[model samples]
Target: MLTITLAQADGSWENPEQIRGAVAAFVKAHLPGNAAQAHVAVQGPAPGLRFPACRQMRMGFFGYSNPYGNQTVAVTCTTPSAWTIYIPVQLVMNQAVVVAARPLGAGTLLAADDLSIIRRNASNLAGSAVVDPQLAVGQVLRFGVAAGQPILASMLDAPEVVHAGQEITLIAEGDGVRISTIAKAMENGRPGQTILVRNSSSGKVIRGTVDQAGAVLVPF
Candidate 1:
């Protein structure tokens, strides 16, 4: 059996199974003759992470070729008793190494054997949180990500902070005593829309429209 230990090549604390799985894919490509065996180790995992077993029972087949024939097998793993464990296996006429591991004692595997299972279970694998101006990378993806989630490139142009129900005074084109005072009922006011206002002296309520200067226009 060829045993390979997973070491931290990248600074991120990535999922151990994900890293090992990539290596497993590599091994599948270089299988000797028509059969091969591999033992994978993941070291320095957070405490409580369990070792996985080699999958048993033919679950199904994926990625088929007409000339090379089809593969049908189960993907399961044996649990680790201590920090490290071995999974023994036998195979014929196939070059495929797939590793599935969980955090210490995390009993479930990362990706399922079935494509439908992955679609129903796994989150975005190719998505990134970072935003790009040229490419619309930060837009929320439904069922995969949310919409209107702020983007980094547009963050520099975030809307100015404004308060709701705040009173703002604008000099009236008429008498200063009857100056227009608007109470913002909501943020992002629209032009030519009626807004509520209060008379500073008489405490009376009046309706006015937002004008070009972002000020309420009262004709009285």
Candidate 2:
């Protein structure tokens, strides 16, 4: 079992560094793994402001949220003469993430040469980011990304494998029967995207899911 205690932090009087240290310790203790280091930053108010310290200082989360990102936590004295104060904390966690190798323009397709894995402060990463290179390769970017910036999920999109007026094999399944015929695509779409396809025999427009092999799957 892992346990930590900060010395000379008894609640006789509030100490600024101790308060910060206690939060830092709390962040480190709450972190998931040893691969990332948690650096707690207590924001707002003067750290040197003196408050009546109780018998013992304890660290607690401000709410039900996990202690990550920008969060608020309570530093309370849990002994005789209880006093609790809320402090804003930002946990700067360092972890590995995928980043762009160079400045990538909008609509650029992701390739192995254009990406690299790098360790960065997780707090600085916005929203969510792509961790594996395989998950990003062949995907098209919807927006321009700066070099060395984390490749976020919102920044990339799947490229269309089939284009409008393109010829493909249309497979229709119904009543435990399968039929295949050559058809022309009426709209552009990527794998698994539903698009309109025109049957070459009857010229009827129908919607189907585009497969990776450039085949349209339709269920009747």
Candidate 3:
């Protein structure tokens, strides 16, 4: 067991348990996400270590340490004597995140059954994992994911509405005049994405934005 001592103005010693509790509370209050999910383990001062009586005390995180995982807290004493000590802390926070239920191939359209929600250590995650099933469902996978692998936001993409070699209507409007032409898409594109199209009528290549209706809109 570790013991830390703090002295009040009356010369009464503060309980070491209170000091540990205070440090845990301080870390929890500053942690991001749900504080209730965080578990903090604060290591007390070294054995037989003693600090002089202090009328005023302040505590803060030392250096560039993050709020979670292994960290250090600096305790500063002010008043009759001024001193500082570093306390080690361990923090773990579990959060629900989406993961693949089975090995899914690249380009596969995700469905509700393809994903599962599980509690994982947020501090150890490599990237921001998807949390909502609705956000993953109907989305196309950019790369293959193994079973039980956490699904990151970068791994999913919007379904392509226009495919290469598909015939689509290209429309351009300016000065109250609107023109439409049939064109072939040069590449796959999702809604709102710019793609190259070859106009069948003029035999010319043009860039246009794919619309929700699957048509390409050329800027004037």
Candidate 4:
């Protein structure tokens, strides 16, 4: 609903500023997501290019799915004269996202101090960029990340909670009764992952899900 003021001394030809303003307003209304900061850059019409003054103007996105990045908008006029013009518009949307606070190496266990949230242009960021510091914390980096670089989901992995041949607690519960025993993990396992383990007392192999506390829960 935001529009720019039109200053036309003679209502004879279409004003380039008017066209640019219309495109800017339309983009702002259709932009996706709540951007922390938005900037719309509209290119002016070429010099000497003139069209008859239109009583009404209609604007629409030209060959674009969403109002983001570099795009073209088609402006049509019908009343005094029927004409269409394509105006180029650039949309830069900034959003808060998680980024590495300092240079980190691969296999580094991320902690709260390793990350910081900052506003960055959404278009310039990867689609998998992490937005929450909690998501990056306690996770292991799959690759080295540069200082001040945005942390991406693909760059992290769940830390391995159970390692091969490691001793771990195995718990089983059923019918209001609980049982726990020492077990040796047969293979490495991450949080919530199921892996085979051998009960130390019985020497029996069983499958159990690794919990966040590094304990394995088996079926009763």
Model 1 Cα shift for residue 175 (angstroms): 11
lDDT per residue as tens, model 1, 10-96: 442345464345434533544443234323222323455544332211121223311122222222222221233222222223222
Q: Arrange candidates by lDDT, highest first: which order?
A: 4, 3, 2, 1
TM-score of each: 0.22, 0.73, 0.71, 0.63
Ranking by TM-score: 2, 3, 4, 1
Top model number, lDDT: 4
Model 4 Cα lDDT, one tens digit per residue, 114-204: 9999987766554567888999999999989899999988898899989999999999978888799999999999999999999999999
Q: Please report the TM-score between candidate 2 and the true structure.
A: 0.73
Better of 2 and 4 by lDDT: 4
Runs in model 2 with CA error above 4 Å?
A: 1-22, 29-36, 42-45, 54-68, 76-79, 174-177
Compared with the true structure, all predictions reach lDDT values of 0.34, 0.79, 0.81, 0.82
RMSD in angstroms between candidate 2 and the native structure over all alpha carbons: 4.2
List ranges where model 1 is wrong by over 4 Å: 1-163, 174-188
Expressed as tens digits, the lDDT of each residue in 1-220 for candidate 3 is 1223444634444345656676787777777765457788889877677676666667788876675466788877666677777888887778788999999999999999999999977666656678888999999999999999999988988899999999999999888999998999999999989999999999999999999889999868
lDDT of 3: 0.81
Worst 10 residues of 3 by lDDT: 1-10
**Residue 107, candidate 1: alpha-carbon lDDT:** 18
